[model samples]
Target chain A: MELTGAQILIKLLKEEGVKTIFGYPGGVVIDIYDELMKSDIRHILVRHEQGAVHAADGYARASGGVGVCLVTSGPGATNTVTGIASAYMDSIPLVVFTGQVPVHLIGNDAFQEVDIVGITRPCTKHNFLVKRTEDLAKTVKEAFHIARSGRPGPVLVDIPKNVSVTKIKYKAPGPVKMRSYNPTCNPNKRQLQKVLELIKAAERPVIFAGGGVILSKAPEELTKLAKRTQIPVTTTLMGLGAFPGTDPLWLGMIGMHGTYRANMSTAHCDLFLSVGVRFDDRVTGKTDTFASQAKIVHIDIDPTSIRKNIPVTVPVVGDCKCTLEELNRMLEGVDLGDLDKKRKPWLDQIQAWKDTKPLAYEQKDIIKPQYVVEKLYELTEGKAIITTEVGQNQMWAAQYYHFDKPNHFITSGGLGVMGFGLPAAIGAQLACPDHIVVDVAGDGSIQMNIQEMATAVQCNLPVKVVILNNGYLGMVRQWQQLFYDKRYACTCMEHAPDFVKLAEAYGASGFRATKPEEVESVLKKGLSTPGPVIMDFVVEKEECVYPMVPAGAPITEMLLV
Target chain B: MLDADKHVLSILVENQPGVLSRISGLFSGRGFNIESLCVAVTTDPTVSRVTLVTKADQMIIEQIKKQLNKLINVIKVHELTGSPFVEREMVLIKVHAKPEHRAEILRTVDIFRCKVVDVGAEHYTIEVTGTEEKLDAILSLLKPIGIKEIARTGVIALFREPK
Candidate 1:
């Protein structure tokens, strides 16, 4: 069909099965917005470009589909950088469309012009700048393909202002075929055999899983492998819900603020089977001492992630689901009559470690942040889809809440960006409207994008925000206390807005809990509210998250409670 | 300690937009040092061959190769090793060729098997293609006479397998 580039974009988006887009219109994108106005697809008008990206990210995480967003050029494009990097670090699939200056004015630094492609190259999985209207369909298709394929990440397509209005003969392209883009799905039999041997021979085996398992939708397969072999599973922050958190074999998240048993088991285990994990610095602590006694096995879709950080005994480059299925198939043929008997002593040791100081915090007259997370967790019964802003509040939530399903616990794991939780919770609620969605936020991080409460109010998302109001940048203050000899410089936020009034101003219900006694009633009331609700609990400002493994120190050497 | 070593890598990639940027950006973004680089289209119109010379320890180079292989347009990456491979760098040297120094410069050019592609009244643009060592030797010989201008295309290499 002969259509303008804007119409072609709509057609391509429909072809890709994109039903909704988070976007904000601007000068260069007016034509596209005009076409969108007449199209069947829904458009969410966010207050800023960052919110658009984060909303898309939240939607992607919740729905397991590529989230789409559109924004104009220059500042509009630059504003999405943090959100794009957050998605990139966490491996979220998103297709972002940005308007460009007319093709001729691209390099001339025209008004509202930016080299977004060059700027985003280091962060994006791949990006495109469409010059001709005819190439729009193909570029759109390729962008979707690249964004969702293999180890999925964000992809950007920049459309020139003229191209959006120019008419072109458009044809739907065939399936994308890139010779070098094929990701490994099936695990090598030899490597799997080696892993099997290691699992069979080792006395203590720990299965360290990560976000890849969730991204691959292989939680069932991973659980199968862990249960059949009777190996305890520890998850990264991103991998929180990949394994059922309530299972007896489930050790809580591993790394800096990891559970005692999880970190100890990892340190002492003879075999570590890491599935779909990149072993980021936060997870490994110190590379040289990480899993020193273990023969590590890493399975991931990306080959570069195999040995990028810590050395591994066996590296299998393949999709997590496919690889786990292959491992289970091979295990079906093996005799494991006495596997449990062999792992009994190891299980006992891990249980002992779990008994020793397992995520402890004292409850005083003041409302504790950890207590708030625990109460929320109990209220939701581990069923709410929870997102979190970074720092102390994030850690408290991670420690207190237990997730039983994939995509239930979403956070800015890699980037640790503040202002993520509220928008993310809004996006998640948008994706899963039937379920309860909550954003556990720190006082400092919540204020970063408190404006998004208005978004929740506008969309009627009913995203409950539980702010641990510690009146300081809790994480940085904790670091200052531990590392810098209590030099609290610029970490305190003494002059902050009254959050309750602010939430009411945004047309949402607001509540506050001043003492430990008021925490429960406030939580119950805020959660039961039909629309967006913000509940701020005044927490102990001096309290710190425990089991701190200093930077570059091994996880074994932790400053515990 | 793992000592650092220089290596040449030949990569075949799709002759498409953004592939070069992807490759170069991968290097620069990751802080991998690229000593030299050369790129040209292959016999196949749709494929471009990129030759890059980089210096890194064995681990970093392995990581670089793995990362380069991950790019969507990269078809293959072959790291050249040992003395069996042939390498070349092309240099265009414009030496001061006064009437008195003309004979000596010509003799030096002849010794290097270089062709004088262009000539001015006082300068000769001589084209030389050989190993880096040979180019360095010729450049040093012309240095005494004051080389007016020089342009060098970074290394391009190929493996000399038994045929």
Candidate 2:
């Protein structure tokens, strides 16, 4: 059948089961917008291109599908770079489409034309510039396939304006057959047998999970392994919900700002069965000292990630879920020999460390940031999908909120991009309409993407923005105070717009609370509101996230409060 | 010097516009140095062979190979350093040849199995194709004759048949 490139794109999206797209239309993408109007796919018109990409990322994280976004060329494409980098760092599955100038006009400095394919080559899993109308369908198919396949990441396809309007004899492309792109999904049985042997013999073993577990959707298998072997589970920031946070074996997050018990356990463990983690520097602290006493068994789909940071004794190259399943099957027959009784001494030691330096803070007259997150978690019954911006607000949310399911807590863990939460909440809300979506943002982070509030209100997303208003960039301020000897520098933001008024101006409900007692009531009101709402809680200005390991220091050498 | 750190990689990639850039970009982005690189269309017109030379330790070499394999355009990466391979590099040397030195230069070229492709009134442009060590030996022998200029192609290689 004859169809325009734009129509073919829409049909292929439908074929791929894409029900929603976050995008912003511009001169080059007007044809795509016109074609989109004739389809049932929901198009969220974001205020900015960055918001569109972040929203798509959030939608993908919430729905466990490839997120799609569309934007114009030049500045629109450039604006999405930060968002694309963030998704790439976290391994979120996303397909970003940017409208380019015509094929003839390319490389001639045409209006709204930029080498987006070249610019994003480093960040995207793969990228393409569609020069012909006939290649659009196949390119789109390949983009989605690469984005959602093993070790998923964002992919970009730059479509010229002329291609969108050009007619083509359309046919659904065949399944992706790139011989060079096949990832190792099923692990070798012998390597997994070795891992099983290590697990059975180790006296103190810890399961270190990361974003790969969440990306591979192997939380169930991971939890099973941890439970069956009686190994304590410690997750990286991006792996927050991979294991139940409230479980007795949960060691909280492990790394720079990790729980004292988790870091201590990692330092002392004999075997580290790290599943799906890349061993990022933030998670490793001082690489030489990280898991020094442990025999690490690193299992990940990406072979390069296995020994790129810290060397491992056993490296299994395969998908996280498949490897875990194989390991679990192998464990079915082996006699673990009374795991709980064997692990009692290690568990008791961990418990002693936890009891000695539990995550705590003083609740003064001023509202502490941790108190707000705790209250929000309580009022929402721990069922809300929480997204956070960078710095103190993010750390506090990762600490206080206990996630009982995978993908419930979404944050920019690897890239730590500011202004990610608000729009991400919008995307999450749209993905799961009935779930409570909240952006646990700081005073500085909320202002970065404040324009997204308009997008939320227009869509009636009912996304609650809970701003921890400390009147400063709290994380940087804390660092300056601790290390720089009270040289605040530019971290202090004493003069800022009133968030409640700002929310009201965006045609959304607004509330505020100054005292500690009013925090709970304000959270309740804001979360219970019908449309989009913003709750501003004035928090203590100088409160710091404790147990911070100084840069380049060992994770065990933490400065506790 | 025959150093273990130096490696020759034979990579097969799709004959696309930016495949070379992507491979080179990967090297530069990761702080890996490309000592020499050459590309040409292979027996399959749609595929190109990129022979890249780099100096790195075993771990870094493993990382480079894995990273090269990760690119979608790259079909395969083979390390030819340890394998039985026939490698060749072409070099053209322009040496200053006075009338008195002409016989000596020609005799030296004859000994090295090189050809004096171009002859000027005062200089001779000699062309030679051989292994890196052979080319180096010829260039060093000709350098004492006051070589004017030189041009060299990147090293390229193919595996030899098993006996």
Identify the leading candidate in terms of TM-score.
Answer: 2
Model 1: residue A227 alpha-carbon error in angstroms: 0.5
Instruction: Kindly list the per-residue Cα lDDT of model 1 for residues A1-561, writing each as its tens digit.
Output: 689999999988998999889988889999999999899998887877898888899999999999999999999999999999999999999999999999989889799999998889888888889999988888898899889889999999999999999987767778777777787778898999998898878889999999999999999999999999999999999999999999999999899999888989999999999998999988899999899999999999999998888788999988999999999999998987697688899999998988876889889999889999999989999999999999998988888999999999989999998999988887888889999999999889998888888788888889999999888999999999999999999999989999899999999999999999999999999999999999989999899998889988999888998
Candidate 2, residue A373: lDDT: 94
Candidate 2, CAPRI quality class derived from DockQ: medium
Q: Write the per-residue lDDT of candidate 2 for residues A47-147, one digit (tens) a residue.
A: 99999999999999999999999999999999999999999999999999999999999989998889999999999999999989999999999999999
lDDT of every predicted structure (CA atoms): 0.91, 0.93
TM-score of each: 0.97, 0.98
DockQ of each: 0.74, 0.77
Model 1 residue runs over 4 Å out of place are B97-102, B119-122
Q: What residue pairs are clashing in model 1? A: none
